[model samples]
Target: MLSMAIGDRIRDFRMAKEPKLTQEQLAESIGIKRSRLAQYEAGRTEPPLTILKMIALALDTTLPELEDEGVPVPRKTKAVQDAPMPNVPQETVDMPYAGLVPADSNWGDPLGTGEELPVDIKFKGENRFVCKVVGDSCYPYLKQGDIAIFEVDPGPSVGTIILAERLGDRACTVKLLEWDAEAGRSRLKPLNEAYEPPSSSPGWQATAKLIGLEFKHEGVKMTAIEPGGFRSRQLAWRGFDI
Candidate 1:
């Protein structure tokens, strides 16, 4: 049987790579089809020992690390290539457009939705703020058009998906937060492998806390992005049980 846990780890490590190995690229490197890689990632199939070893090499990860069950598959703390920061709006003021708040803005108070999405008002608190996605770095799970609802300074734990800002970053980004107390650094893992992995140095501050995501789809609904770094809709529509 395909182990969902293992598959989840495989997918995370693939995305956590320095440059990120796409399904197609990783499959090609291992002499398999992209569909097979997708199946392996989705937990529909388990790869053979040989294929698994190849995957570890292709992702620049150790096979022992892959085989270890206790280890988090992507372990966001791992170092990867550095990427340029994205440009974000400097305005902290709340815009009139759909209750959208910029990440850099002072979001001490809850933003006004102005009757845009049918968000669960119960979750709206002083700590929660809504910020629009600025780039495609976290695609599939978080898109450019999607609006992110974040909780400010919640003191997130390891493997929490967050919308945070690094010291040298121009804007806040959506990433999986992994803390390394020994090294005094944090790794910000992106969902999209095309973009490079981001991390935090000393004096890193989370710009906003990622509570959930609001996607502008056919029907206006609220979905919490899972820590697995995939859209909740794709995972059998188990929306926002978190």
Candidate 2:
């Protein structure tokens, strides 16, 4: 029987690394409400199994690590229990075609094709933005197929993985961010060692910026193809519930 309070353990885990990230940011990463996280941390409420799993994922820990003795059994929400978990990943391809410039199109008069249209995106507090991941840079943590939730004004600090955009590029591939004030530089590192190291060049090289991070939502499991075209892994949701 686990003796520690699961909620306390979770709170400790979150605070251990990201002391600067607000409760709201942590909640967003685990797909929960800020108030709910506060309640859990205060021992006013206990998370259900699904939420527990999401919290574990966000903290980079396992469910067993959050176990506590005398913790009540988790009850599935009525809606979740009634409806089957939606398999949204099946509706789209894992790796989409990139760099489809109009001039390169074999079809004459690409503009007349009427396929490309400009979309007006309205940023709202509740709306979620989907960002397509690129590069094998953050392998084992974030892969090419993963779609990260881009939360504007996330207010991230050091050691956080953010979605930064460069000049003429939509966004950057995922990388761990580190700020060095003494050197007047920010270091972007990959969890995978196979990728090239960050440059020691000058003149604001690479235009690396901090965007939002990939977050998983509880109960939303994504299916992703393995590297060798033989296996698959369920990529869990990594977004916060507003």
Candidate 3:
């Protein structure tokens, strides 16, 4: 049976794009009938893997992005001045903080509820959280003393940095996740070449994928920073909105 959540997400994704597409347009782009697309979006029909793939391509997103449990949509920040701000609509979302998870090890509870952090996200869902990094293995990209908010089990796709915990380990690691379907295994590659990569036979459990973190800003303004400044208090990762 098709869940309403999937249907809603399909419709949401279709409408959220710039120059929002109609059902008929999306159907034509995906090589499916408009009625079939409507049925898929209404949860009356479950889309097969092939159709899902076509939909993903038409939407300009990865397949995992479509099937993920929830999407992360960051809220817009307001100015600090007491003066009347512009009448801009903003959305607020809460993400759980799962305490500190190591970047060099594989361990941590993705569902842990140490605290909740409020941020603006593009996708609205309940399966997101933040965790502090305690190691330097992911240095130069993710830094120690920095925080990471992850979208829990948003499925897996190539080139995504993930928060993974081994089945029998007490620690978790943040690294680039890759899957080898033919070998029936998964590999965890670190951004820092100094650290050797690891692989799991049954495949590492993907608890979450690193979204963005809460960083301190000097003032109530959006400042740009280099990619290396992901650890900085700037909202450089805002590009993930795509």
> Best lDDT goes to which candidate?
3
Backbone clash tally (model 1): 2
Clashes of 3: 16
Candidate 1, run of 10 with poorest lDDT: 80-89
Query: Global lDDT of each model?
Result: 0.54, 0.43, 0.59
The residue-by-residue lDDT of candidate 3 on 115-188, one tens digit each, is: 77655443235676767765446644554445566777646665577777766654577877766688777667
lDDT of 1 by residue, 45-158 (tens): 888887886676555455567766776654444322221111222223332122333244333334454433334443344545556665445544555556666665646766
| Reference-based TM-score of each model | 0.42, 0.33, 0.45
Predicted candidate 2 versus true structure: per-residue lDDT over 80-166, tens digit per residue? 323222332323322211222111123222113333221112211222234445444454455443544433323345555543433
Q: Among these predicted structures, which one has the highest TM-score?
A: 3
Give the better candidate number (2 or 3) by lDDT.
3
Which portions of model 1 show Cα errors greater than 4 Å? 1-118, 168-170, 179-185, 199-203, 216-222, 225-242
Pick the winner on TM-score between candidates 1 and 2: 1
